[model samples]
Target chain A: MAKENKTNINRRQFLKSTAIAAASMAAIGAGVTYIQKYKRDENNAQELLRPPGAIDEDAFLYACIKCGLCVQICPVHAIKFAGINEDLAYGTPYINAREQACDFSCDSIQCAETCPTAALYFIQFKEAGLKAIEAVQQQGPEALKNINPFEVQVVAMKKVTHIGVAKLNEKTCLAVKGKGFSGTPRGENFNGVLRPQSIKNQDGSKIRKAYPLKEQKYEREICDLCVTECPIGEEAITLKKTTNPDGSVSYKPNVLEGCTGCGVCEMICPTEPASIVIEAGKTYEEVYS
Target chain B: MSLFSKKREPLPPKKNDEMPHSKLGMPYKEWMGMNEDRHKWRNRRWAFLVFINLLFVISFALDLSLLEGSLSGSRLLGFYLLDPYNSFQLLAISIKTEYLPYLTMNFVIGFFTIVIFYSIMGGRSFCSWVCPYHFLAEWAEKLHDYLVKKKKIKEHSFQRGLRYVFWAGFILLAFFTQRLVFETLNPVGILSRAMIYGPGLILLWVLVIIAFEIVYSKRFWCRYVCPIGATWSIIGNISPVAVKFELDKCGHCRKCQDVCLVPHELWFVTRGKATNEKHYVGSDCTRCGYCVDVCPGDALNFTVKGLDKIL
Candidate 1:
């Protein structure tokens, strides 16, 4: 009878311990997942400006390993990893255009090339680059004399790269305010670098050299940095003279379908807090419409 | 008794009490003074941790082709290296056929390289030797021990098996959410990335986990919640490198068990308890060498499955 009692106590103790462990595990697991679900909802709502060649935002979030390879390979130093507060997007690379923009001066989308996972799907740009080269090849040797195949390939690659669309805030725009401000767009303290349109690379291969904004000076009758400094040029954005309600001519920057939302316009804007900003992950149709 | 009140035990003489005071009459000792004998394995582990993690920082700063990228994924001299746990989470999230193409051959090679390397080194060696978070947690554990010894707090513990449940939970979380859900809050990845890319707000999460270890339980995250450790523990099952025990050499002092990170693995080392003359530590053992370090009789030792005979 005593032996039976001892066995019963041992079994009871084992059951009790197991029950506690099971209960605790269940509680902790459910708690963590619950918090994660809440954070994930908040995370998905964030529309971040991703690196060039990034896929659709939802799919990109799923596919990105948060490796930061894109951040390392970006020659312009445009990409930065998202903070923990970004939740699901934490450690994922994003371009803060105001800080630095993808100038595409590398003539190669190195970030996309280095991406092990096709989170930044390079094949789209790769196909576009191939098509540009193929078109030049088809045009015979005469086309090659006038046209730089490498430059055309890079431009075509840039066209396919839609990270976001630039939206203009007309109220804060210096051009709309009818102001002709001079000196550097950003002050002498600004550290942002860009491959200026006037400066050509010594190599003449169309891979432009980047210079700090502090070192470059700009004199304009009206602020047209967004238009003049655009890497994609006239196809992406244009400054147009529009007649206002007072019958006064006001210059406005017009965004077109060719806008890659590479965010050069947003980065170069002289106005504090930026007069123009990229609506991250928005397509040309979505922004214009 | 009140709900929060506890029975206070009388304090014993601390190690600091016996040590001579400084010239200024302040209590002084070696920084993080552990009175125990010089731990060779622990020193080697700290060195490896510092060197490996430093390469990640140096490579990025100098733009060296060696060991680029953080722990999540890296290129060692243009060769890919991926954290197996993080890679597995990616696999779970992108399990669909269409997504398979996105996961390139480089990822496969990186994953296998990490697996093979860890397996050869005895799997959980990564936890003790290479994981920066593990090193931090060890410091937190020392603080925890000090608190416990000083009678300031009691040691709170949980079933170590909870980690296996967490391991499965993370994979399922990835599958259901279609995201690397844990990476957002993973301390291991956060610490590793912080070293390479400077600290971010995510480091707050790591701080909270460490605080939990110190105040609530000793090594809470590592012992009960780390999916990375759990994943390696599974790989450790097949690992040939193990902590071998000789029954005759054991003094029955049980000091090894006292120092073991996972004490359950060394349960058979008790006096007259082990069935075999020689027994190998269980898969759950981190093979951290704490047991070997603390063993006065030199009973416990690191031994490769077949290498001991040749040596």
Candidate 2:
């Protein structure tokens, strides 16, 4: 009888630990299932205005280690790491252009260069970089390329690929009303970066000094800051003339494919929410969805 | 010399023990009873812990916010400090990086390799020896002691049953959100970022969790909430390298029990209640060697399996 009792106790102990191990596995399985059940479908994919060289939405999620390297590398301090509240976007880097725009002040696109995983590919901005490199390599520094080999790189970067498309809300546009802006675009207290009017030196080189929007004023009869001051210049946007119902000719800004969605136009628009907004992702398709 | 490695010491063989205490070809050190080698081993482990934590904290900080070109990733020298929660989240959520030329799959391979190695080495060894949060948690416990000295408070309220509950809940949350949801609550993550970018939301969470620990519970996160701890416990259940108790040598002093982080683990392991014929032995031991260091009778020593004769 005592021998049987010893076997029984050993059997019970065996069962107890086995149950615990099985329970741990079961718990993990259930938790994974619960998450899979409620996980957002692909339709919920955020059409984020990712930093310049990011890959596809689904691929980006898997590959990004959330190391925040790109965020630290942006010269304009435009990139921000998504916080926990961003949900699936958490730990990824993004640009909230209204708050800060990637001005490409660092002409080499340093963020892409710094990405260890290459999640932000330098190739997206490569056409311009390649063109500039070729121009300098093939044509000597003294050769007059239509665009300065250096400027061509940055300006062409604003042309080839885009973060998103800029859309103008006609009803709220100041130019639609034939009204122009005067004084700082964001007003006296704004903290956004403002380029001191680009001026051509006697040597034919352009020099740009920066002043905060709160400190500078651009007075105009037609609101053309979005077109004229655009880093992409005439390539990204142009002021088109139109006649209003009152027989006054007004200029409406037409955003071309060259408008690389820098959001500088949006920031300097002088409108409260800015009439032109950059809808994130290439083309406007499926952005809202 | 490696700040992250633990030097294995051979336990003194019992008079009639079957297995050889030292593996073949190893030079055996004399087991001079209760000597400085014992104390030096414990002190070295502590110093190694501090060295590892400070080394990473500096490099992680400099590489993160200060440096131009830096060595990157959470892995170095084949050691991965990843918590299981983060690794599992990376898999379940299907996270990918945008625009990068290479695959983020490198992390996946490293994460799994570390998990397998940890399971073999006796799990939670990382937690006790290498985790930056371990020392912080210990300091928090010290603060709790100081607080209790001035007032009246119970030591710890560890409920073992609730461990898997929070563990699974975090995993489910990671899955549902398709994000590393628990990183917000991870003190290690919080501290690393705090060291780099200065104080922010995650640091605030760290302060709150540590303060919550000092006032309300002891080692509460590791005991009741860490999913990684739960995963390690499951994988490490049969690790050959574990703390073995020579029951006959024990004096019933209870010193080992007082220093153990896990509740009643020392009691059951020492009393042979957790280890009997047909039952596997380890009880979520961190292998921190605290109980081994504190044992007055030289009874508790880390050893490989086949020591069930004590039962």
Candidate 3:
């Protein structure tokens, strides 16, 4: 009996140790296989919106060090780390447009500026978006004078389509519903803003003044906050007048070619979930793939 | 065969009381100044980790944008964001979402270069020596040691294997979900966000971790759970450097295992007896040198295996 007890103790230790070792090996193998198979799938990431000036979704995934630096330095605190449920974008910085938009409150994109690697690609903004880059290569910051400074800086440094275009959900939009709004979109307590554009007056003289979107009162027979409150202004979103079934005219928010997707419209939209949503990391391609 | 070799006689001195001053206990004249060098590599590791974490925290806290173009405000001075998991996440997500080629020079550098660095370092020296969360965990360990005073303590052995499961599950889930799911639970990201943005649900997660570490865990998070440590440990298994044992010099004091985060690995390596070649070289061994420092026998030292010949 004593001899059998000794043998049993040794056997138990052996079994326990082997089981742990085997589990570890199995886990490692499965992990490697999972990563390998995922790599082969082309449509694994159907949608992801990286911060502006990010190179590519795949490159951004590995390039970002997950330091949370970008999330830290945003002047408006627009940037946030992706939550655990967000798959591979976890720990990486991204913007949730409806909650808060990248107002460029830092004058330029601060998140991209502070990224250590080319993950955020400071080079993307060094030239600005492609057009701004082309403009600089052709004329210089002087040629970019007539355009919005923020637009010039961003476009000169990166792709215009770096983020997605904002599409308005017509059925719910205040303007599309033919409902006129008279007060602040979010209420007096809110702190949202409308970036005053370099607008041309009657004599074509430009007037630019930025004010809190919540402080500004709107009184249109058809609400145009989606257009008026858009930080990118007409360059990104526009109000298109259309005839309703009652023969009454209403306006639909149209995303234009110049939409750089700063996502201000999505933030200031009066709708609960926001009538406009930025389909992050998309182009005119329009499909998820 | 067992993690605890045997009960140690007397008690080890706490770190605070090790130093004495005139107003405090020993006179200044008798002190002959302070012998600050308690553990060479161990203290150095502590200092380096503190420096790294401080730099990371400060960089995350500062706003260089206001000082743009100024030397003090230079945007270049940000944290390395050098967590290995970032590259791992990229590798997993890139494969699942797109083809492998979507990876770039940056991804290649972060992924391959860092892995090579870990492989050469033997095991995860970074976890004990550089990871931001480690400094806090060490303090928690010290606190637990103080709190667990005379009571018999037992480790939840099952949780030891959970880290392996976590490491594997994280990668597999990343592939299946094509999300950087591990990033959400990343202590660095969570803590950094908490510090920079003010405490919220992220900090709540931190509180949960603190409760686990201080109350129930023996540094279980790092020893078994972290995927980053798991990755480094695997890569570091064949690491050229390790904490070697001098069996001839050993007094069988078992102080080394008492201070070690992963004592089982040390026990495994030093099963029959401690020696240079077969000494503790576990992958998850963070090379923190707690074992080396506390070893009353002076049997352990960080060494480059084969290079022991030159010495």
Query: Largest TM-score belongs to which candidate?
Result: 1
lDDT of 3 by residue, A1-289 (tens): 9999987886776567546755654564456446524642543432335677777665565456566556767667677766544433445677777667776566566677666555676654654455554656587667667666565665444334356777777778988787877766677777655454433457875334445666666666777766875555576678888777998776788887667677777777777768877777667457222
Docking quality level of the chain pair in candidate 3: incorrect
Question: What is the alpha-carbon lDDT of model 1 when measured against the actual structure?
Answer: 0.77
Indicate the worst ten consecutive residues by lDDT in candidate 1 chain A. A39-48
List DockQ for all candidates. Answer: 0.28, 0.12, 0.13
lDDT of 1 by residue, A124-145 (tens): 8889999999989899998889
Rank list by TM-score: 1, 3, 2
Worst 10 residues of 3 chain A by lDDT: A39-48
What would the per-residue lDDT of candidate 3 be over residues B1-311, giving only the tens digit for each residue? 21223433323322333332322576544443232235776779888876655554465567442212111012233212245665565567667554455343444544565677778886778777766577788888787676667454544444455566677677666666554556656675566555444455556676777768877766767766677777777778877788876654444446567777777667633334432323544676788888777654456788897898687
Per-model TM against the reference: 0.83, 0.60, 0.63
In what order do the candidates fall by DockQ, top score first? 1, 3, 2
DockQ computed for model 2 against the true two-chain complex using alpha carbons: 0.12
Model 1 alpha-carbon miss at residue B256, Å: 2.5
**Model 2 regions lying over 4 Å from their true place:** A1-48, A84-89, A117-119, A126-128, A131-161, A194-217, A243-247, A282-289, B1-101, B104-136, B139-187, B194-220, B223-311
Better of 1 and 3 by DockQ: 1
- The best candidate by DockQ is 1
Q: Considering lDDT, which of the candidate structures 1 and 2 is the better prediction for this target?
A: 1
- lDDT (C-alpha, whole model) for all candidates: 0.77, 0.61, 0.61
Global CA lDDT of candidate 3, please? 0.61
